[model samples]
Target: MSEATANDFASLDAGQLAALRRRAILSCAIGNFFELFDFTIYGYFAVAITRAFYPSGSMYGTYAAFGAAFLMRPVGAIVLGAYGDRMGRRAALVITIGLMAGATGAVGLIPTYRAIGYWAPILLVLCRLLQGFSTGGEWGGAAAFLVEYAPPGKRGLTGSWQQFSTQIGAVTGSVSAALLASSLSEAAFYAWGWRIPFLCGFLLGPIGYYLRNKVAETPAFERAVETRTVEHAPLRVAMREYGTRMIQAFGLSIIGCIANFIFVVYLVSYAINTMHLPSSAAFSCAVASGLVVVVLTPFVGALTDRVGRRPLILACALLNLVFDYPLFLLAIRGNTFKSLLIALICNAVFQALYTGTIPSILAEMFPTRVRYTALSVSYGFAVVLFGGFAPLISTWLVDVTGNPFAPAFYVMTGGALSAIAIISMKEYRDAPLE
Candidate 1:
């Protein structure tokens, strides 16, 4: 009955709606890619970084330090998510990208432990925290921006591109790091070769900034502001009105966090440490899996649009539970390129189902005023619980069980938890965000 509601209803036509949705998807995806690239580059280059800064330390200690950086992510999410609700999604995104770029560029220039004593690790942790904070803010803003601009009938498809961008960034970071590492001598790679990917983030940052600036504010946000329909305190309102949805989001995110940390981070470590594969080979597998994820992400997104998010997410979770042991067994036992390929393929396919639909589903869970806050808080908390701890937990599990397949069981547990959570969520495809 309101003017904004009337406009939304009128804008649901097929032709012009398609064009706007495309623009939104492209803008959100490109901007998100840069943010994720900066975040993920650390994981891909963690070994080289550890050697440079913690040369005499145990591998577990080095990884523990790395996980410490992940702890800052939820704090960033709470701060920036609230800001996005109060200020604007575009402003939050712009700020986050700038922070990520600055932190990443500084990483390239950080002195080695030999040069700065304890100051080296201190600086590294500081920069990583800043990067975590920036990325924490980036996800919710980007998701809300894309989903709000999506066409009525195709919101899931358009929103999925935001997740797809993460794979694009991961692939880029892995390939670039592999190429740079390979091109340099071992001595050179340890000495100075590892900084290239971090430095590359400088170029990516500005490009993301430019692309994001071109995107208009989402119509949903604009309408809420124009009509003063926004909640007085979005965080409180979300807690009061949408607490159950927040819980659902956290559960739905478990499998994705598990898959990403295991396949992308833990697998890289496992290949290098356990299987004794060359770092190049390990990175190549990661790059290959990322490429597969990027390609399959959109298709999964489209599938969600047709069939709904609940079924797709549950199916992926169930398949992950079934394939968990076999996938890791293949990757570890054979330790061949072929084995890695099969494992990576299975992980990527299952991951795509959840990743592709999450943005739209989360955005649709709340009204425009609180969408960013709700999504960011729930998502960031899940990352802290599931993703932030996954690598460390997987390593600890393996050490305790002395079985290489321990990580597979850990991964399956997460999938089972997610399946239970997602299956209970209320369907909202036809529900309007008022």
Candidate 2:
């Protein structure tokens, strides 16, 4: 979004800057790839996790535990976001990846309720809390790192690597789940097979640590330090200086949060449990949707550079608002993988518009003085409120209201609010970052 399209390489040669950009993007995107990989597995296989950690008939409590991870996110955002702002983005990124990898791996190794009774579920919750805390800082840090390292005027496309990598992670989780579900017997899947995905998450720590450490610091963060502009108390500075913008960021993020949770987290389980579809069907739908988002995100992100962020997001929100009910109805009516795939692709297109542009939009909002803290805390708040609770709330709504597609109403509400927020907020797609 920075209007300064000219290179500011800090006396580096063109080749050096280009190499730095590639490494920076790769490092950040891989961290994001792992974060979403583990998180998506947890959501896609929530039913199995619940069974492993809780008493047999505790669907509601399982979802509650799943959502509980979100509550810790804001706390992590405050602490780690400040760490990024005060210390450095690289430091925050390294710590987040390490914490996330450890917690995720630990979840797979924990004893089941059958083995350890109540302590099993409690331990599961603690691991999720740690994962959630690390994740709180991951996105904002990645976005800031990439957007800063990006070639001037090319932030939209570079920033979108974050969402692009996220979709890669989503696809990995879904495909892995589908393969295991279709191959292994249900008894095996619920027993030991499920632990494979979580244990694989442990690889994230070393890979991410090595990649992040290999790259140089971003141009923006380095400049901040050189100019002595980095704040000592970024949280307080952000709250006091950019409070209104933070609320606007929350509103803008709400619909994307719900849409993501609905498609990536809740929809698969809804198909498997509520519709009695095959587990493979749910996994297929997730992979299809993630692939679509992955393909569409970078193009739309690049489009935002030409057309501005407002129009793209407005189109996304309006399309989502108009089609939310119909998309669900179509998927419900068919109750087949093909039907769900079509519906998900449709939803992913509109969803991509927001996600594609959002990294640039978020990074453009607050000045570099508190960019990481501002974006992290606002995104953390939005996810905790709408994204995390979506699974439990959607299930509860269906149970109480007897409407299987009750979640669509929540999506529509978010769409309307998102449209309002976009119209009210200033367009910063062309503004300078600092």
Candidate 3:
């Protein structure tokens, strides 16, 4: 056996293994946390970005810019995901975090339309596209890193930290935006305050790079490398061997992606624009709702390890399908902080269950050689089609239909699609990773 495989993880004592797992989790999760924060802050400050970049009379331009990055995700997934399979998970993760940090920081530094005219929005879209590409590579690598390190029968619980860190990043973004908006004068906020969050996102890069550098590459990937099982063309290999599994992964992701974008990212806009809530109230509701996901998701993930993945996934999809419209109605009727909180929390509960389980399921669907490429491409496609533009689509749907509840139907449709997808999926909770 090669040196990489000769240093058997099985030789480590319990404490040594535990320490390694913790380091791996922290290394992977922090980068994902930063990546999510980078994206979440953009969504949180979309309105300010719209005013700053788009001289065009339409907010659609800004939303389109926001969605544009997602268009590059699949390309990134194919390119970077293959890089992970060929180079190593740690190398791909380190590169992704650096790219994300730089792209995110660039957004804060770009001159506004007032100064740069058309160049301002153009630069902003480019930054977003870079962010999208970086994120495309980050998620699958992180998921694979976490699951590959997980002890047998504990993959669900360990993998769930990926989502946990995501919620934490999102909550931090919401709270940061809320605090800045509440504390700064509207003139100051609209002037320069919004860029602060993006600038701070830049600082996350060095930290994530340091953390990832400290952790060893996953044993699974090391074994693949040692055994010469790493694919030279992982994306092509994945498509040829795992086409059906890729579709299953995409279907499994649809509702979670849509619901996350709508309930978590778009809800702030919905509260402010549709319900006419104060920005503070809107952000506060988002923070509370995100906290719900943050706290419950690990528990839900742990539960899946016990009860099975399909049950919770089915429950999440079915509940969202049935109750999304009613929950939207409940918020609209009262139009109060309490009602919005309740509605958002209910929506968040469903999201937590789905997010908690989906990462592990996606990671489990393919063999080590193509795991990164297959899962990332599948997820990137799903997010691009359903999640990435969800806020923009929801905004447009409500605009054209003149019905605030129209976005709820969009979310419900995702739930239905996901339900069908999960119904046909074989349970892989206890299956040994190849």
Q: What's the number of clashes in each of the models? A: 0, 0, 0
Model 1 Cα lDDT, one tens digit per residue, 115-228: 998899889888988988888889888888888887677888878888888779888999987887678887898789889889989767998887777766677777877777
Find the 10 residues in a row with the least total lDDT in model 2: 1-10
Give the number of the best model, judged by lDDT.
3
**Cα deviation of 429, candidate 3, in Å:** 0.5
Window of ten residues with lowest summed lDDT in model 3: 1-10
Model 2 RMSD in Å is 2.9
Q: How close is candidate 2 to the true structure, as a TM-score?
A: 0.96
Candidate 2 structure quality by residue, lDDT tens digits, 226-328: 7779899998999999999999998888889888888667877878886788997788888888888899999998998888888998888888889989999
* Winner of 1 and 3 under TM-score: 3
| TM-scores, each model vs. reference | 0.94, 0.96, 0.97
Q: Name every residue pair that clashes in candidate 1.
A: none
- Pairing residues by index, what is the TM-score of model 3? 0.97
Q: What's model 1's overall lDDT?
A: 0.83
Evaluation by lDDT, superior candidate among 1 and 3 = 3
Best model per TM-score: 3
Candidate 3, residue 365: lDDT: 89
2 or 3, greater by TM-score: 3
